[model samples]
Target: MDYKYIEQLIERYFACETTLQEEQILRSFFSQGNVPSNLSEYADLFRYESSESNIHLGEEFDARMMELVERKSGMKNKVVSIRGKFTPLFKAAAIVAIVLTIGNAAEQSIGNRPSEGFDDVTAINPYIKKDNISAAIKVKDNTQAETKTVVKSDSLLIENND
Candidate 1:
């Protein structure tokens, strides 16, 4: 058979002008082992298409894929499924949490009742004068302002280093 028509079809294929029939012809021609030397480069591509077309899934393939999908969905449903196997456990945990919170609140109220005669920790420190505390806070505020200035300068230095 004259390969001239096949060559023209190949050119049309590259130019996106070949019809489906012409492409099928090209695939059929190139799939044969006896390809001309000049067209040998295109033989592999068409042969690959032939091999791909012959590929068939196994009989159990769909079952396996669906099993995988169902497994993933079953895992996801476990997260928000309130009525499933863990429902009783979840209810017990919530009850325990509520009981603990109420117990903690009751304990705090019993202990927090204020009494006289310097029972708190603050009265033990005589050096904790209000004036000294305010002075220390002002010093801390001044140090924080200096820290902000230092941070700004350090950022500029880092950028310049980069």
Candidate 2:
């Protein structure tokens, strides 16, 4: 059992100069437990590599990674649900505000209607008669008519002599 070659490879391994094949040979040699007392400390290192090479991330890791992704995606779903819940309320409020504004405008227009009643009279008749025009003109000027009346007082009594 000439370990000289393995020792040389271990020296290369420590200096980070060993090739992948040389490293595999070293791990196989140390895994047999025929290492010399001087080289026993390095045996554990090689054995650890062999064991780690055999190890793999199991299905549990994959499941956990998928769960994390689903959790993150579910947060987005909840946000969309919340927004969807409020969307109709927002639209309804906007519609109600528009309706109220239109109703208020109609009410204000009705309140501002003209007080005079003769605005629609010309719409029914385009031609004006001379007597109607004279009457309309007289209606405007009739406020200046003057009249006087005398009242008899009852406090003064005169006796009649026969």
Best by TM-score: 2
For model 1, residues 19-125, the per-residue Cα lDDT tens digits are 99889998989877799999999999988987899889997999999999999999888776846778899899999999999999999997787755433434557
Best by lDDT: 1
Kindly provide the TM-score of model 2 when superposed on the true structure, using C-alpha atoms. Answer: 0.47
Model 2 misplaced regions, further than 4 Å: 51-75, 102-162
Query: Tens-digit lDDT track for model 2 on 45-110?
Result: 999989998888999999999999999999999999999999999999999999999999999998
lDDT value for model 1: 0.86
Query: Clashing pairs in model 1?
Result: none
- Model 2 C-alpha RMSD vs. true structure (Å) is 13.5
Q: How much is 50 displaced in model 1, in angstroms?
A: 1.7
Q: Estimate each model's TM-score.
A: 0.39, 0.47
The worst-scoring run of ten residues by lDDT in candidate 1 lies at 115-124
